[model samples]
Target: MAQQAYMTETDNQGSGHEPRGTRIRRLMSRLANRLFAGGRDGRGIWRRGMVLTALAVLVGLIMLLHAQVPNTIGNSGSLIETFLPWLGVSVPVLLVLALVRRSATALIAVLFPAIVWLNLFGGLLGDKAGTGGDLTVATHNVNADNPDPAGTARDVAASGADVVALEELKTSAVPVYEKALASTYRYHSVQGTVGLWSKYPMTGVRAVDIQLGWTRAMRATVTTPEGQVAVYVAHMPSVRVKMEAGFTARQRDKSADALGEAIADEKLTKVVLLGDLNGTMNDRALNGVTSQMRSTQGAAGSGFGFSWPASFPMARIDQILVKGIEPESSWTLPETGSDHLPVAARVSVDTSS
Candidate 1:
């Protein structure tokens, strides 16, 4: 009778919930204690996961001093720089592993990569584009196998760009693009696999030899109301990645050098270069061109403005670089049937310059 009375009183006081909750809390506490039990010896947080700690530090150093990394080994340095921004992804993975191992050392070491990544790429996360621009130009590498060439042409025309550059043009489909874009662009020129359509009058239209033994580049003077601006359209040789050959870009690099040389010779003060360079400005291989020009995307675009493999853009290979023109804003257009998404930039064109 005494035990029965005590049980009824206990159940009435808290309905037995408090004891169950307390037990669960205690169980969690025990697990935590076991996980963090050792602090001064083997199996301790400081001593565990040293490899992870080392890896984190190494990743940080690589990003911090990526330029120092040599390109001698299969142009490994260039390859790394190509996707350098993605290196930040390793930080979170290392952090998770450190937590699983309860490793304080690794936790601290992960900060190295975290900090390095933030320092390198954090600036790109914010908005830098300004308002107001006189000229809107767009570029696209419409694939040769596009199922709807006419549709692709129409999509590009819809961007309302004063100047449009199309690369990788197929001989048979040139007529389709001409007819589709004819309504929007009155003045246009096609040189080899590349073409330029302009709302303004185009003069000095001719092929630019990029040392490819054929014309894959061209230059024309677009007489915009603001003034005449030299526009260059180019398609650098494509690069391939083979297990044995690594980033086989020797051909592309040579082509880039030739193209850069051509741009450097432009007489016009205001110039706009549009193309699929097959490489990024971060890449040292394009220094011949990048050294002189300014990237509109880097100067005025929001985010990375990646414009390749239209399905999921990852890198900003398509570029709109300017000399003497000021980019007010830059952006990537909606995907068309082409493999590449069109990239456009609005810029302040001062003819007097």
Candidate 2:
């Protein structure tokens, strides 16, 4: 009897007793088996399918009308548009879940977001380096408080751009920039804080009134070997989103409207606009400008080149836009001593049109 009791105790310790973690895992396994049992059955498959379909529909809706959503909450629309490329992540995650659930319905639903995401941002996924252009133009917003004006000027001039448009020039640093770039660029024009330095002669220099009380924009005609190109350097009003106010860009919008009107009234055939517009092409607030000209990045660049906060670029506020020109290529330059990185575009003047 004693031997039998001891044997029974040993058996209980060896097999019947389970550690806390093991017990928990076993319970979870049982729960999973219960939940996933007969997963291919009608009700089980339908439930999983419905959940994935809901996810697919949600992603689709955001992709379709993300722009229509108001900026009432931290400029949510612009924020989403800024990081719009990230929306692709949802498709793969939903796909994995559908595969795990083994639901044909969910698997099919995953295709919706995948298709929508591809349609929206697929073009930006490939290499865009194809050919060179006749002219290379660059734009940079040297911060007003930039510590190295000479260095910034040197960096931009070294880019070998025939024309460079600079914005946010401070009163004290303008001379430094002028001296640094004068050796490389023979012709330069400045109006208010915005300036344009060109290797070719400049004409028709004037201040562009963006409804700002002071001058923050200018236009000049750069005479190149190929032909004459009208260039506009503009520094739009800055925008901010705060807890108290959401996407406060009233001033920037007004400035954009004024700039757009000026562009419409422009008599020149070949026109290029460069500056820190303080917004992306995706933002409807810049429709005034976007409606008039084509973004070089969209026309020729490879990916979504976000170029702001020079340390770690998150959104592209600097832009190079053109009308009546073919952009062979567009790209962002290395970071400079400014808050914004320089944006460059190589464009050929189609004088035939």
Clashing pairs in 1: none
User: Which number leads on TM-score?
Assistant: 1
What overall lDDT goes with each candidate model? 0.90, 0.86
In angstroms, the error of model 2 at 149 is 1.8
lDDT of 1: 0.90
Across 10-102, the per-residue lDDT of candidate 2 in tens digits comes to 665345555789779989989766645554455664566677888888887888888787877767787677666678889989888876775
Q: Which ranges in model 1 have alpha carbons more than 4 Å from their true place?
A: 1-35, 39-41, 351-353
Candidate 2 Cα outliers beyond 4 Å, as residue runs: 1-43, 49-53, 71-75, 96-107, 351-353
Candidate 1, 153: how far from true, in Å? 0.7
lDDT of 1 by residue, 88-200 (tens): 88999999998888888999999999998988888778778988888999999999999999999988889889899999999999999999999999999999999999999
**What's the C-alpha lDDT at position 349 in model 2?**
80
